[model samples]
Target: MVELDSRVETRDGVALVELVVRNPTDTARRFRVGNLLDGPLWPPRSRGVPEAGWDDGGFEGVVPAEERRALGYASPLSGGARSDSLPEPPAEIVWTERAGETEAGNDASFAAEATPEGVVRSLGDHRPPADAVPTPRSGDTVSTPESGRSEPDPRRSP
Candidate 1:
């Protein structure tokens, strides 16, 4: 399982509600993020985590072991809505193990060990600048390039 935390910032004009997931698993596996039941809807331009379910409403992706990943969606500001209402992402998250993957029974606990300010500052260093293009580390899909988007994996991305 991965521990998660939420943070929001206005990049340009979009209200980017970002979630940082801490993967403590030893092997690479995919994780799922439930929908924002209380906050604004996720926009199309919003990147980071992969969409899950047949309808692509939720998020699914691979997080490398002992690494931090920023996965989130963005929403354009609405006239009637206030950005203050944005919900802080939950600290608890679940990492779904595939059929062949080992299941580390949820015997351990996940906690937000770092300060919020420290986490925010660290995220800035992981991602690349807006104008940069990502280079592929795997065959087809392009992972997060210079940005702290995603950690590198020798195997295919889920």
Candidate 2:
């Protein structure tokens, strides 16, 4: 089965409609949502061109099994006008079809199973090995190549 939730908001003389379509069944479904408002429907634009199916005052696509898809459109108000009344629900499910069915109760099997055998290490970690770290004895002076000078290692008391 399919379910739909719709909302509309007006901004700058344009009504923006958003719809969330949900497919609860184990089968994928294709659906068409038609514009229910009085104004013309304007699907979202790509590179200044309206999306496909904008002329038909509606949009259509597939919703995967057990998934929800969000769709949106815009309708420009006449003469940059504003209305005090909230627009009626801007979209309606005009039709729906079962695109395909999946194996029963197989939804959770696609996830890969993993077991952590040891501490994970990344190639970016350039730290030296534990035993390779230098530990200076108390009162020892360590020489640094950068300054060509010897300084007491701060880790141990002088």
Candidate 3:
């Protein structure tokens, strides 16, 4: 099951909203926290690409299994105006599913693999360390300061 708790506060001419979404089930759940109040939603951060939940008339993100995630947004009040009525059940659940169970699950190549580390690491992360010096490959001419000469790298078998 999913649980939602929301609080709204008006401060400095803006209405600040804080929401806590909880997932108490064994499966992870996806939810949408709608903007039931007046004005456009401004996520926690405004710069760069827009956050996950702001574009769809609300905030949308995943709450992991047996875990909760906090989401918040702010809306500017018009001339310090106030609303006498508030929306009931400020947030609603869109859907929930087992973690990593996607439509692509039917494909063997796209299946998700759980690791002992409890985190998925990308396959393209094999690049050398950021600070590591570039090594000359086979057939590349390298200049050596010790010998003061240019020659094929000794590290490679000719």
Tens-digit per-residue lDDT, 13-96, candidate 3:
787878888888877766666787667677653223344335547765667778888877787766647743445444455555
lDDT of each: 0.52, 0.68, 0.61
TM-score of each: 0.44, 0.56, 0.54
Per the 3 Å backbone cut-off, how many clashing residue pairs does candidate 3 have? Answer: 2
Provide the global lDDT of candidate 1 against the true structure.
0.52
Q: List the residue pairs that clash in candidate 3.
A: 53-59, 53-60
TM-score, candidate 2, is 0.56
lDDT by residue (1-158, candidate 1, tens digit) is: 67677877765556776778677776665676664534455633312422222113456555667777676676666555566665555223544654234433221112322544334433434555555754455545436767746555544333
Flag the better candidate by TM-score, 1 or 3.
3
Model 2 worst lDDT window (10 residues): 113-122
TM-score of 3: 0.54
Worst 10 residues of 1 by lDDT: 104-113
Ranked candidates, highest lDDT first: 2, 3, 1
**Cα shift from native, residue 36, model 2 (Å):** 0.9
Candidate 3, run of 10 with poorest lDDT: 103-112
